[model samples]
Target: MTDSQDHFDVLIVGAGMSGIDAAYHLSRTLPDMRFAMLDSKDSFGGTWHTHRFPGIRSDSDLYTFGFEWKPWTGVPIATADEILRYLDEALDENDLRRHIRFGQTVRAARWNSGTNLWTVTVERGVETVTLTCRFLWMCSGYYRHTQGYQPDWPGMGDFTGQIVHPQHWPQDLDHTGKRVVVIGSGATAATLIPAMAETAAHVTMLQRSPTYYYPRPKRDELATTLQALDIPQDWVHEIMRRKFLQDGKTMVRRSREEPQAVAAELIGAAQAYLGPDYDVATHFTPSYRPWRQRVAMVPDGDLFVAIRSGQASVVTDTIKRITATGIELDSGQVLEADIIVTATGLTLSALGDVAFQVDGAPVDLTQSWTHRGVMLTGLPNLAMVFGYLRTSWTMRADLVSDYVCRLLAHMQDRGAASVTPALRDTDRDMPVRPWIDPENFNAGYILRALDVMPRQGDRQPWLMTQDYFDDRITLPAANLEDGTLVYR
Candidate 1:
């Protein structure tokens, strides 16, 4: 038990946005505490670093996604590279780059309640390292390390041509002039189909089911002008952030209350881009309510333009099998293709599969109850910060970070050893949904987390308000007087 191990007051398991934010606050408030951040990859920015697929951009606007302390001066809808650069800048600005240990994957973390510390085991190449910390923060974003989900299709192995998954898009795999079929109707499919159409001989987007699509402008002119004019960056960020949040909230509300109207308007606009003959209902109409899952965002309607120009096409049908020469549909139709891109879907992993332990017992997250989609009931001295599917993720992440900081500060003031969400509620009749979407559809990892995540209060603190203004008050500003959170 007394093996040689580096000990820290706080140990962060990721160097991405959440980890960076935690480090920033800890450094400012608890500067005397030893802190170190470890990441599995060779760099910071977990998702931004892992996902290198073409045409990958932030679906959410930058305003709400921007950090509270750091104003995002870049364009509203930013590319993945741009976001990575921004994250790199944040690390440098806060002098957090040196404290990070790259290529160190955390295998497991065990909590010794008696010692009041966590023994973290990590793998770094050939060597295994163990570290100890008083507090552990998990920030390895979801989706299980960029591995794409590939369902076994009948006759898949029979096809001689190359099959590609979006999560592992091969850089050298040339598809020029090759008839390509992209499967799945999620965000990735919408993004890749349009971009791939430019060069592929012909592209077909095959969707197992339809999804609601909304076209968003690529650039916010007001945001760009303000940034250029040397205006207060936070001011611009705040205004634009509020506008976008309101826009998204309105869309969600309208989709729920006036599903037909909203659906018709969106379908009409999308169909106008395509021809009158294109089957919008078959390809675009989803079975769930609008905003039930995150509505796919299309900037500039590039997909629409691609379809309109006859460069790409959408096909909504059940995939029966992958024939050597083409794809067989459930309707008894076979479409020929030279190459197939299974933009199928991604496998959802729980907080990057971080192994959790309470009192030396392995924690099964599926059996745990989510508290505010950020913390877990009965999970002590820990919190997870993944965003929601319905609203901008950063909106909740920012709030959670502030709240966690405040909670830490509260623990310090009270001379408490640790804090946790206590499961002392007497209400046994409370409903419980799966920890995430159990069906494994591509509705997005964050959205599924919200469905099972706990609401703040029935009426008092207010439920998980996706709205930034309400969250700012309830999380960062509201009194942490709730009995559910205990300090000891």
Candidate 2:
């Protein structure tokens, strides 16, 4: 434990997108800082590495999804392989590979106020190791990688066909010429249906309710045009990222300001893709307004194309039970299939479900309040790297990494050992709200984890929001001596 290998200036958990970005910023802004990036997987790319589902791709465009400092030269919506390659290059180009340890999973982190250090227990293969760090950066993603969420249906065990979850797709289970039924209507289902339809005999999307879908070409015209003109990748990345952000901002604003109009436009887009005679209302139109949960992307209108070709179809009905052969709907209709893929959703895991302690007491994040959505109240030298729910997650990750570096430098300037967020006496009466506003964005994973997440206050720095535009302004100009953050 006394060896230099056991100690670091900072320990960044999860060597995925955010972890690599944090390491890059630390190397550039805090060059002398000794840091390490750790991940449970055998390699980088958290979700991408774990999800081997066919035709797996990003829901958001890669322009903004890529690191702010790095440029993405691939299609707007990139595949899992493309993203993994990009992450690999980010590590190699920034010399961040040396700072990363693969197959190292953090088990628990205990904070010591006396020495202002955190002793972390890690599971590395067959060995248990202990490491100490002055600061802990949580870059691990929000969902559980080992298991995906699937509802227990009345007869799931009775189904004769192969039931599979997209999170753990089997390598040997080929869907070629198979009668496949994908349960769910989110991004994963949208992606799987189209890909499976290409080879499967026929694919049917069974959904309890419809989700809003936005259509866009696979390749971005502007990025392609600029690339064709021999423009530099960095400039293309900057311009495209800004362009996408502005357009997304306008759309988000319109959804809030003019919900009905936005909803109609979204529904109409589906009508245009599927033919005028097609019934968009029964299967494509959602009862809620646009962006209520998430408007999944239908890249190249593939989902509709599959529908048009009769290779795929949608069934809007509640499942009465999963019979031995297929699913029985509430309408007394049963769907028969050779394979059933459950693209239900993901399960949220706080701090990768790692146990934590502070000052010899078990740390319960549900009792803590988020300080600007990064640092938690009463947690010294620990900050999380959560991202935007509506926008590309990397957009917020970049901003947070910058702010963390700035805060670290500020603490160094004052010769302080630790900084923690604490509510002032005047803040005692502030009402607490859910971690995320359900009215704005209510993703199932976030809602399910509400009881386990930190509370938000009614005022500044305490009222954590998903508004990226407001955050872009306030996070950089955040006040250090605002009395909300206590330094020791």
Candidate 3:
């Protein structure tokens, strides 16, 4: 049964980092435009709110992860608590809390071409609520929020230890003086080993394969120096942001041009941290090239230090099965442990898994093509934010927000209510590719769910470029009058 009907000029989904970024831009640019934000969770912080595992921190620097308008005066790689505090401050300072409706999960949205409106169906508790909006902005992140990816390993009826996934970590979980085994070699496992080693009797990082690990200082010396000079916060932010972005670009370029040199440098850094006798080549060297998957950040070489001090150790082998005591390896080795932490990767969920329809006909996102990495082909007045993989997610989020604002202004100027990206005759025959090329990024999570995502064309506007520098320059100067985007 329908409980209520509400209307707005724009409806923004998910109040996470991307959603917050969109709200900030929309409020600043289109103040008069009637807009409302929806978050499935009760609170504002999306990822920060959900991920409460031990040693949870940002992989990217705070200068870039933090909003462009809001300067983060904290460590480069901030903890979950610090990030949450920053988000809370942003929410209060901007007065955005008033516009957000908590516990409203959008189930489906239908586009009415004749009326130039989207009828959105949201599940609010037991009753269904309907809302109409002129435009839809999807800020929900691209991952399953309720669960993390956990593979079913061969096991007996029970293991003596507590098997836990970091996503759904128990608050009262006690690992003190207990032997802990953390599975997987991603960010979560890297973070867990060091922190758990502090209290645990011993921590073992068991990995099926190696991952690229880069150790960086928690604090930025240049940022501190600029602050010491009495420079404004915004100025310092801008300077640091640009420098980091440029440095990232250089690193990517170097990785592509001189893969061996880059790999060697990374291995050398890990060897230095773990000591010369450590097996850096076996444990730290990845089979794939650098940045193929995200390079895990080890702040202040904590993981290596933990390993060096004999608090933690790394094991490189495939798991055969889970025994009552611990996991048996393919090499006929058994790891005895009291606790097992499955730090497995995430499962991808695009656009909050909402179903779409166009005047009663089902709209399949997998069949559609992306436009400027934001809007989809044939989807009118809709924008979905998917950030860059190589750099800070907020960097791309800022650009997308600016572009959407420009688009809204353009529509208003033209007195247009419907603006859709239409496939022209020239683009009809263009080669369509997967959403993200496997060659570009072969991360297990992405590859596992690539078929469900929207496709990308080989040409401009339709092509999804992961390069932040390219997007920063191209998205701003993009002509609204381009024939590809039909404004009615």
- TM-score of every model? 0.91, 0.98, 0.97
In order, candidate lDDTs are: 0.75, 0.91, 0.90
Quick one: best lDDT, which candidate? Answer: 2
Among residues 3 or more apart in sequence or in different chains, the pairs in candidate 3 whose N, CA or C atoms overlap within 3 Å are: none
Model 1 residue 277 lDDT score: 87
Tens digits of per-residue lDDT, candidate 2, 46-117, equal 989999998999999999899988889989999999999999898899999999898898999999998899
Query: What C-alpha lDDT, on a 0 to 100 scale, does residue 143 get in candidate 3?
Result: 89
How far is each candidate from the true structure, as Cα RMSD in Å? Answer: 3.1, 1.0, 1.6
List the candidates ranked by lDDT, beginning with the highest: 2, 3, 1
* Backbone clashes counted, model 1: 0
Q: Hey, what RMSD does candidate 2 come out at?
A: 1.0
TM match of model 1 to true structure? 0.91
Model 1 lDDT tens row, 140-166: 765677576777999998888888887
Judged by whole-model lDDT over C-alpha atoms, candidate 2 comes out at 0.91
lDDT of 3 by residue, 1-488 (tens): 22234888889998989988999999999999878899888888888888888889888998999999999788789999999899889989998888899999999999988888999999998889889999999998988888899888989346978999898899899999999999998888888889999999999999988988889888889988998999999999888989888888998888888988999988899999989888877899899888788888899989999999999999999989999999999999999999999998888987789999887898888989999899998688999999988899999999999999999999999999999898889899988799888888888889998989999998889989999988988999998898988888
> Residue 488 in candidate 2 has what lDDT?
97
- TM-score of candidate 3 relative to the true fold: 0.97
Q: What's the C-alpha lDDT at position 85 in model 3?
A: 91
